[model samples]
Target: MSLLTDLKHDEQFNASEKAVAQYIITNKEEVLNLSIQALSELTYTSPSTVVRLCRKIGLKGFKDFKIKWSAELQKEYNAISNVDPDFPFTDDDSYGEIQKKILELFTDSLNQTSQLLSPDKLERAVELLLQADKIGVFAYGDTYLPALNFQNKLMKIDRSVHMAALPGENRHLATNFRQGDCAIVISYSGESKNNYYITQLLKQNGATIIVITGNPSSHIASLGDLILPVAESESQSVKLSTFSSQTAIDYVLNTLYGCLFVSNYDKNQSKRIASETLFLDERF
Candidate 1:
């Protein structure tokens, strides 16, 4: 994991450590040139606190932390300088430029997500899905499409998947989940109150919950039994479109579908082919 990702995901850091981390993240370029005492003074902490923060993040000391952080920052700078993932195209961009920018946004989003994905967490999520008696997918707004797509994919493989976009219907479906069942919740911010309540309801029923979210520190993420973290560049634009989050969610769901399909490859392939054949026959 990158130091920034680790700082975000790891909750063991105390207030002082987090403060130091935030300072380092915000002042990445300047950190490499600052002495331990200088950094501590800048962050309103002490040199010992800085050293402790470094140790907590798996670095030997301030020097090692600077070295690793500098390298990571350089890589990030080079990547973003090529194509700004968050705002790849502007209002004045030409048609061809817009197309190219959109492509770059999606490609970079997937690559960043892939780099941060944890194989162990993915395997565990698949195991939970395979063991569940029923699966419920939950999402709101723009994320609902990917959730529905995942439901359709699972249904093709003969898995019972349920999803509800409405609040009352979501609650109803969540309430029906029992022990040995699983709920897959998709939310980029992981702060939707509706999804939070739904996840709470699933927990109340003793069902396992898998959360696919971009924010690791969100409340919904904390409630998850298994979390699929999606890394993307943060954006504050009020644009109607959400590019990176949706792409990340789709990629994670597709990866999960692939893993599930391969777990029982022969049976799944037969079922999928048979389903397609039946549909074609009905249509023709």
Candidate 2:
């Protein structure tokens, strides 16, 4: 992601940092040669505030931010993605063409999601999963399906995971979770009411939070310890369907499941074998 892109998406910025970010984004060309003091002065914030913003976005300081920002501006970046996440197909398309578009849409969605879900975040999520006493999966609507799939995988692996997505029961689940427990909350917008409330409960209860979302600039994302962002291409309110978002969620959950399995490779393999054997008698 570009420096501006990070500034726009990441919700971790404070009010002062946000002011500096707005200035930098609105005056991109001006920032090319701008110093910390000058940029801060333009934004009416301090140089320290500018440096803090720089650090929040993973840069060491103003110089480091400048180095990365300059390189990104100089580099030729690609168009958003090969396929449009929202409108991958049209009314004029034949079934054959639609099939091709569907395939490509999923391909593109997974690619974008993989890029957004950085390796360090993935590693941290898995680390938390390994450390947690129990795991709870929370989501609403379309996002819940991927959470269920992940829950099933965790259960099969002998990991104690619960689907807390049931209506009216998330609060109960949240309260029940212990300090060492983990909550995997999935929401594309990152601002659902139930998710926000339940996440708040989880937070107070001292459970670790791992948020899977598309929008990082959201209240839920701020409450999370680890945020695994999905493809940011799909519009929150407008879309042909949940195709791209669903695909992205599934990819991220499956990646997590696969990573967890690989973390304890031999033990998980044996567990899978044992699980298969238990179901072997059901020929139907």
Candidate 3:
């Protein structure tokens, strides 16, 4: 489990212990440089509370917690330093410079996403998708393109998948969802009100929910039966468009499609070849 997930879900932690855990999560970089006393002072808790929090989370002590936290932080820092996803190229940048920066941004996004991805969660998602009677993809705004891409890929493999980028169509689809179905929602912020409503309706119909988001702590992520977290570049300026988020989403969808393709390789391949032949015959 992620440290944030553990902190959020563990019922054994008291208020003070949770407070220390939250402090560590929010100020991980600073916590790496602080002593137990310093951390306790910052969190307004006792040193004993800090130690207890660490132990509860399966860390040996404050030092162990700091070491693990620091490692994760370092990985994030390296990814961010490699690229600024929002403004990867500027007007002053030459064509070569722009190409190099875009390549760096894509590489960094994939690398960081690989680091953050949980193998168990991925396997679980695959299992659900394979067994689902129908797959419904939901996304809005910038994420809709990737959602449509995913739907197209799944359709080629003879899977029952549905997606609607528009709100009215999406609402109709969500209402029609049944038990044993699965809904995959793509949202970078993981806080879209429309998504939340659609997810609720799906849940009411007993469909399994898979959420792909850059924000792990968002409410939408908490509702997911399976959560796929993507790495996001930390930039000081607000982003007007999503670059890394879309890249990460595409990577995840492609990976999932690959898994599905391999599961019934002979059948899927034959179907794909037949489909290609038919299309070619018509065109020719």
Candidate 4:
């Protein structure tokens, strides 16, 4: 029987032990590389209890148990592998197939966000974004690419905007924010410790926050003044995927820019366009 099936019959364990064991089994996909100490803290069980549990399960010790458990989880995940969007797609795929995939991803994402996103939350978010005198964006991994794109887009319209191209471990750029500033944080899982600490620091200083994440329930979401949910599709082979989430973020930025343009309708668009056209010769 699987660990899950075996657990249903193992009523000998106390509630706490049972809980710890279940967490370890259920999270094998996420915790395979974790050491016993890390797993102990994650499962909230003592190291001794962890070892004892492994022996009880007929394993030699914690290390052997974790490896076996991880193998089982991997086998199970492999069976459902096709469900993840990171599956290989040839560059020569028909345009229709690409279009259909994109539509399906975004359509489901929109529906989910529509159901979960409240009108009051959006109003509060927009108000914060509009009121900010400065903006700081921080992201890492695949997420940083989108942050750079957003920074460039924002800078084109607002010269005063500051983009932290790379926020290292210390998040040194976080200190530049002031009371009227806003911090825009992006993370696929919404759980990067560095980003989370930056959010906490910004909030403590009275800065508004905008968080874009694939997992809305993640720790980073709780700190956001505005939460933007991105769609995610994961796989066992490929550890992470960015296609759908990046598309969603780009759409949000475009919408916000449109709103800004409408709000500045009284300003002359021709002058702004001309100011950006300095590279072209007068003959053109």
lDDT of 3 by residue, 88-190 (tens): 7677544445566677788888888988887787788899999999888988877888778878877887887888755678888999888999999887887
**What's the TM-score of every candidate structure?**
0.68, 0.68, 0.68, 0.58
lDDT of each: 0.84, 0.84, 0.81, 0.66
lDDT tens readout by residue for model 1, 130-189: 899888898888888888898889888988788875657988888999999989988788
| Candidate 3: residue pairs that collide | none
Runs with alpha carbons beyond 4 Å of true place in candidate 4: 1-83, 88-122, 167-170, 232-240, 268-271, 282-284
Q: Cα RMSD for candidate 1?
A: 17.7
Which residue pairs overlap in candidate 1's backbone? Answer: none
lDDT of 1: 0.84
Model 1 lDDT at residue 88: 66
**Tens digits of lDDT, candidate 2, 118-176:** 88988999999999988888888888787888888888988878876557877788888
> Distance (Å) between predicted and true CA of 51, model 1?
68
Q: Which 10-residue window of candidate 4 scores lowest in summed lDDT?
A: 80-89
* Model 3 bad stretches (over 4 Å): 1-81, 234-237
lDDT of 4 by residue, 192-277 (tens): 78788888887888888888777788899998878876555443246335565666666555555555555555463654686577
Compared to the true structure, candidate 1 yields what TM-score? 0.68
